[model samples]
Target: MALIEIERVCRLFEDPKRGKPVIALDNVNVRVERNEFLCLLGPSGCGKSTLLNMIAGFDHPSSGTVKVGGHVVSEPGADRGVVFQQANLMPWLPVWENVAFHLKMTGAPKAERRERAQKFIDMVGLRGFENHYPSELSGGMNQRVGIARALLMNPEVILMDEPFGALDEQTKMDMHAELVRIWRESQSTIVFVTHSIEEALALGTHVAVMSARPGRIRELLPIDLDRPRDTTSAQFNDYKRHILHLLRPESEHRLEQAA
Candidate 1:
């Protein structure tokens, strides 16, 4: 079975000011297989984050179902981990402590927490900075800490919503490489939401291209390129062009389709 299944999901929000129910997602269907890095790619307000949130069980669909491991998702569970755009680390705690905070909440012994947190901290390349506070690290490093925290949970799936969006270009690129390595080592499924075409191309095994608000999956494209992708290559650019074409205004896209 697919590790994650989103079947004909729809989400509607009551827009009090507009006096209407706004459709955020309409009959969205997507499935993520085990260990696949799937990027939800589209413009802002495309319901990418909404989809991720549903998978994480932070929100529920207005209709249809979201299932993980063949069980319906109802509320937040430890089986799924989440890393948000912001690290959201506790400012006062050191890195290791922050990464192991979940364990701490469960009354785990400190030594056990330290050992488990160290494994993931090292996995994320933050071994030497375990004692540093969030304030002491760069934006990218803090994000690594957040990733490590999620990894420490040893969840089957990790949900990320534009975790690298705030980083500088160089830092984001570095994190992308690190994340790919971590994903391979951990063998965890990931569903990432991002607006950047290049970022989706760089990280995803498959890219789910979404339409504008009242979002729907336009296409799910397998990224058959080799790892450490060459962004300038013709094939890579071809994929980018196709995604851009899919993302064009609906009228323009239909015109091309009819041509």
Candidate 2:
């Protein structure tokens, strides 16, 4: 059975100027199985984030169903953990405290919170830095803290909205490797949202590409590459070419040579 299911979901937002609801998504459906690393890929404004938001329970679909682990998602729950582009850590809290913030919220004892957070802190490779404040950590390390926090929840599903989008290229690549390793070890399903084709190809077991505005699933392609994927490989390029075609307009692609 699928771990996360989205069926005929659609979202509409009010347009202040137009005084009417604007369609953000229309009749979209996708399913993620347990332990699958699924990437939601598309251009900006295509509602990939919107779709992810629905699964995260940050927003509700105007119509249709979103079920995770067989229960319909109505609001944020501990079963799903979300990591956004920013780490959103508490500046004053040290790494472990920040990672175990959810525990604190639930009134878990300090000793247990520290103990539990330590396991995932080590999992994300931030073991020794457990006492360092977020301000003291690098962008990548802070993001690790954010990831550790989510993993500490031990959620059935992890939702990442371009979590590595703000990092430098080298750091992003390193984090990608760490994430894939962590995913394998943890055996948790992940739904990562990103506009980067290369990033999706590197991490996803399957890439679900969304169409332009009023977004719908344009395609769902399984990635068959080995770990530490080589973007230069012919198979990689073939997938890239196909995805690029799906994302860009024919006229704009033609203009690439002229420029």
Worst 10 residues of 2 by lDDT: 245-254
Residue 218 lDDT, candidate 1, scale 0-100? 95
**lDDT for model 1:** 0.95
Highest TM-score, which number? 1
Candidate 2: tens digits of C-alpha lDDT, residues 197-253: 999999999999888888989889999999889989999999999998878764676
lDDT of 1 at 244: 96
The sequence of per-residue lDDT tens digits that candidate 1 reaches over residues 1-259 is 9999999999999999999999999999999999999999999998999999999999999999999999999999999999999999999999999999999999999999999899999999987898999999999999999999999888999999999999999999999999999999999999999999999999999999999999999999999999899999999999999999999979897788899
lDDT of 2 at 211: 83
Please provide TM-scores, in order, for all candidate models, with all chains considered together: 0.98, 0.95
Per-candidate Cα lDDT values, in order, are: 0.95, 0.94
Count of steric clashes across candidates, in order? 0, 0
